[model samples]
Target: MHLSIFKWSYIVTAVSLVVAFLYGGPSALFLCVILGILEISLSFDNAVINATILQRMSDFWQKIFLTVGIVIAVFGMRLVLPLVIVWLAAGLNPIAAFDLAMNPPADGAAYFPDGRASYETLLTDAHPIIAAFGGMFLLMLFLSWVFEEREHTWLSALERPLAKAGKLDAMAVLVSMIVLLVVSETLAEDAETVLFSGVVGIVLYLAVNGLGTLFEAGQEDDETTADTAVDKALAGANGTDTTDNPTADPSAVQSKARSGGPTQLVRATGKAGFFLFLYLEVLDASFSFDGVIGAFAITSDPIIIALGLGLIGAMFVRSLTVFLVRKGTLAEYVYLEHGAHWAIGALAAILMVSIGVHVNEIITGLLGVAFIGAAFLSSVRRNKALRARGEDPATVGAASH
Candidate 1:
C-alpha cells in the first residue's frame, strides 16, 4: 500500500515540478514544486473532501484543474505578488519595489533614499500579510462551524436559521470582504490594499474550488456509468467473470470465485485517496500563507524568498504527508481535522488583527502549532480512555461524523 502511495505521490510531484519550473525560472519552478508538495501534504484531509466532491466532476474538468488550477496558483499567488505588494507598500513605486525585491544594498544595509531599506524594510512587514492569512483562516473557522452545525439534525437549537440559506463558503467570502472593508477604514496601515488582497485570496480559493467542482462532475458521470455497468453485470445470468480470482488477473475466463475483502479495500482506498489529496492542498495553502508574510522578516528577493522558503517548506510538507498517509496517522490522531479547522480560524484572526496590532508571524505559526498540538493531545487522551473501556471507536464519541 505504501509502495503504491509513494508511486502516486512521485507522479504528482514530478508533474507539478515540471510544470512549475517550465513556467517560471529555477527559482519559480523550485518555488512552485516546493509549494505544491507542501500544499499537498498539509491538506490530506482536504483531499478527502476533494475526492468526495470530485466525484461530481468530469475527467476533462479534472485535467483542467491539474493544469489550469496550478497555473493560476503559481503565477497569481507567487510571481505577480511582488509587483502588487510593491504597489500596496506605501509610496514605493513598482521599480523601487522590484529593485528592493531584486537588488538589496551592497553593504547589506538599508539602501533606500530615506536610509531605510525600502523593499528590504518590508521583509519584516507583518500587518498587511498577517491580516490576509489570519483573516482568511478565521473565515475558514466560521464556515466550518456554521456548516457543521447546519448538519446537526438532533440539535435544532444549535442549528442556524441561515442554514436554510445559500452556500456558507460564499457567504463567508462576502462577510470576509465586508470585514476587510471595515478593518481597512480603521487600520490605516495599508488597509485598503489589505482588504483588496483579502478579496484576492478568497477569489483564489473559489476559483480553485470551481475548477475542482468541474472535475467532480466528470467523476460523477464516470461513477454513474460504472454503477450502471455493475448493475447490469450483476444481473446478467451466468456472468461471474467480474467476481473471479482474488489474487489472479482473470482475463481469460468467467470465474465465479471472489473475495469480498478486495472490493472493500478498493472502496476504502478510493475514498481515502480522494480526501487525502484535497486536504493536502488546502493545508499547503494555509502553510504558505503563514510562510509568505513571515518570510518578510528575512530577505525580499521574490526569487530567494520563493527558493529558501519553498525548498525547506516543501520537503517538510511532503514528508509529513507521507507520514500521515503511510503511517495511518489520521487513525491515530482523531482531532487532526479539528485542529486544522481551528488553526485556519486562528490564522484568520491573526491576519485580521495584524492590520491594527501588527501580529507577528511567529505568533501566528505558534498559534496554529498550539491549537493543532492541543487537539492532538486531547484526541490521544480520549482514545486511550476509549481503549481502556473497550468501546468501539467507530461507534463511540468522536466529534466528526
Candidate 2:
C-alpha cells in the first residue's frame, strides 16, 4: 500500500524537478519545490475529508478517483480553470487568454495594445468573487456536518448544541445565507459580485449534494427491501414463519445486512456513485481556490504552477487519500473527521474574511494542522482509556456501530 501510494509521489517529484530546472535553473526549481510544499500543507485537510467520502465508495469508484479524478484536479482545475476564468472575466478569447497567462506584461497592465486583457491581472481581480464562491461552498460543507447528528464528537460542548439546532430542515443553508449577506455588506468593492457568486455556490452545493443524497437514499431503501425479502425467505427455509416469531425485528435484519461486510452494503456505483464523484470534485475545487490564488505569491508562470502545485502537490494529496481509506485511518482515529470539518470551517471563514483583509497562508495551514493534531491526540487518549478498561479499541469502535 505504501509503495503504491508513494510511487506517484516519486514520479511527480522527478518530473517536477526536471521541469523546474529546465524552466529557469536552480532558483525556479526551489520555487517549484516551495509551491509543492505549500500546496500539500494547505491541503492536508482536503485529503482527510476526501478519505471520509471515498471510503464509502466501491473499489472501482475509488480507483477512478485516483486515476481520472487526478487528471481533472491537476489539469482541469490548475490549468484550464484559470484560463476559463480569465476568458470569462476579461472577455478575451481562449487563445489570447492562454498567451497572456503564459506571458504576463512586466508592468502588470491588463489591457494590451491589441485590446486583449492580461489573464493574470484579470484572474487577480476576480479573487473576491472566487473567494466568496469557494468560501460559501466550504462553509456549507462544514455546517452540514456540524448540524447533522453523529455518534462521536470531538467538541461536545459546541457540537451538541449545533447538532440539536440542525434538526431544523435546511438550517445549514439558512445560516450560510445569513453569513453570506453579512460578508457581502462588509466588502468594500464588488459587493454585488461577491453576493452573486456566494448565491451560486450555495445553489450548486444544494443541487449536487442534494442529488447525491437522493440517490444514496434510494439505494439504501432498495437494499433494505432486498434484505427483508431475503430474511423472510431464509426463515421459511428453516421451517419457521417470520410472523410466528413475535420478536422478529425488521430493523435488526436491516442492521445485519448493513454489517454483513462489503457485499451487503450497497457500493457507491452507477448513477449514485457518479454524483458522489461530482460532489468530491466540487469539494476539491473549493479547497483549491485559495491554493491557486496563493500560488501567485510564488510565481506567475502558469506552467510551473501546473507542474509543481497542481501535479506534484495534488498527486501526493490523492495518494494520501487512498492511503487513509485503505488503512482505515478514520475508523481508528474516530475524531479525525470532526477535526477536519472544524479546520474546514476555519478555512471557510478565513476565505470569506480575506475579501476585506489579507490572511496569511501560513496561518491557514497552521490552523488546519493544529486541529488535526489535537484530534489525533484526543483519539490516542481515548484509545489508552479503553485499553485500561480491558477493552480493545477496535472492538469498541465496531460495537459502537
Candidate 3:
C-alpha cells in the first residue's frame, strides 16, 4: 500500500495534537488522541463499507469525496449535528445550543450552575430519536444486501437461504416493517417517537437509494445507446445489416455489458455519481450517529470531541477507504463486505436495544471488530484453500452484493 494516500491524515493528526495541547495543555491533547483512537476502533467496519461504494464512483467524484465530503463529515456531522440535536431536543435557539456546548459542565456534571441540564444530558435525552433513525436506516441497508442474489456467498448456510427468499417481492421492506413494529410496541420507551423516527428512516432510505438506482440506470442507458450507435456505424461500413437479428438478445447484451454481477463495479458519472455521493454521505451520517453520542463518555467538551473525531478519525477513515479501493482489498477478501454488513445489522440491533436499555460503547466497538476480523480470517483461509487446489485466488469472489 502507498503511504502517500495517508500523508494528509498523518499531518492533520500531528497538527491537531499540537493545537489541542496549545488550547488546553497536556490533558486536552491526551483526550483528543484517545478520542481519535476510539473513533477509529468503532468505525473500522465503516471504512470497509465505504470502500465498496467508493470503488463504484468516478475519479472526479472520488476526489470530491475526499475533499468536499470530508468537510461535511468533519464540520457538518461532528460539530453542527450535536448542536442541532441539543437545540431541537432542549427547545433552545441555535445560539443557545452553541453556548451550551461551548460552556459544558465541569467534570462531566449532568447539570449546570443554573440547574439546567448539561449539554451531555440534553444530548443523551435525544438518543432515542437518533438511534431510531440511524438504526432503521442501517437495518434497511443490511436487509437489502442480504436480500440481493449474489454470485458469491460468504456464509452459504445463511446467505443462500436469504438470497433464495429474496426472490419474494418487498421481502426486505416487509421484514424491516415487522422489526420496527415489534420494537416500537415492546422495546421502546417512547413508542410514538420510535415509530415516527423509524418510519422516517425507512422512507429516507427508500427515497435516496431509489433515486440513486434510477439515475444509475439512466447513465447505463445513455452509454448503451452510444455503444449501439457505434456498432451500427461499423456495421454500415462493413455493408452488414445491424438491425435486430434473431441472435441479438437485448437482455443478454444488458447482462453482459452492465455491471450487474456481485463483483463488478461500473464507474458512475454525472447525476448518477451525484446521487451516489449523496447516498454515501447519508450512510456516513448514520454510521457516525453512534460515534458522536459515544464521544461524550470520554469527555463533555464538544470542541475536543470534534477535533478528535472529525479531524483525526474521519481523515484516517477516508484514507483507509482509498487504500482499500486502490489495492482491490474488497475483491480479494470477498467476505469483508458480508462482515461489514453483518456488523451494520448488529449495530442496528444494538441501537434499538439501547432504546430500552443502556449498552456499553466498548461492547459495540468489540462486536464490529470481531465481525471484521472473523471475515478477514475467513478470506485468508479461502485463499489458502484455493492455492492448495492450484486455482487462482482472484478468479473467485468477484464482487460485492
Maximum-TM-score candidate: 3
- Which whole-number lDDT from 0 to 100 does residue 7 have in model 1? 55
Candidate 2, 176-220: lDDT as tens digits: 999999989986388888999999999999999998888888888
Model 2 bad stretches (over 4 Å): 107-118, 241-263, 395-401
lDDT of 1: 0.52
lDDT of candidate 3 over 192-295, digit per residue (tens)? 99999999999999998898889889877777776765455445444575464434555554454464432234578888789888988989999898898999
Where does candidate 3 have its weakest 10-residue lDDT segment?
Answer: 256-265
List, residue by residue over 150-233, the lDDT tens digit for candidate 1: 322212333345454434446666666777777777774776567666766666665555554455455556656655544445
Best by lDDT: 3
TM-score of 2: 0.90
Candidate 3 segments exceeding 4 Å error:
237-265, 397-401
Residue 319 displacement in candidate 2 (angstroms): 0.8
lDDT per prediction? 0.52, 0.85, 0.87
Residue 204 lDDT (model 3): 91
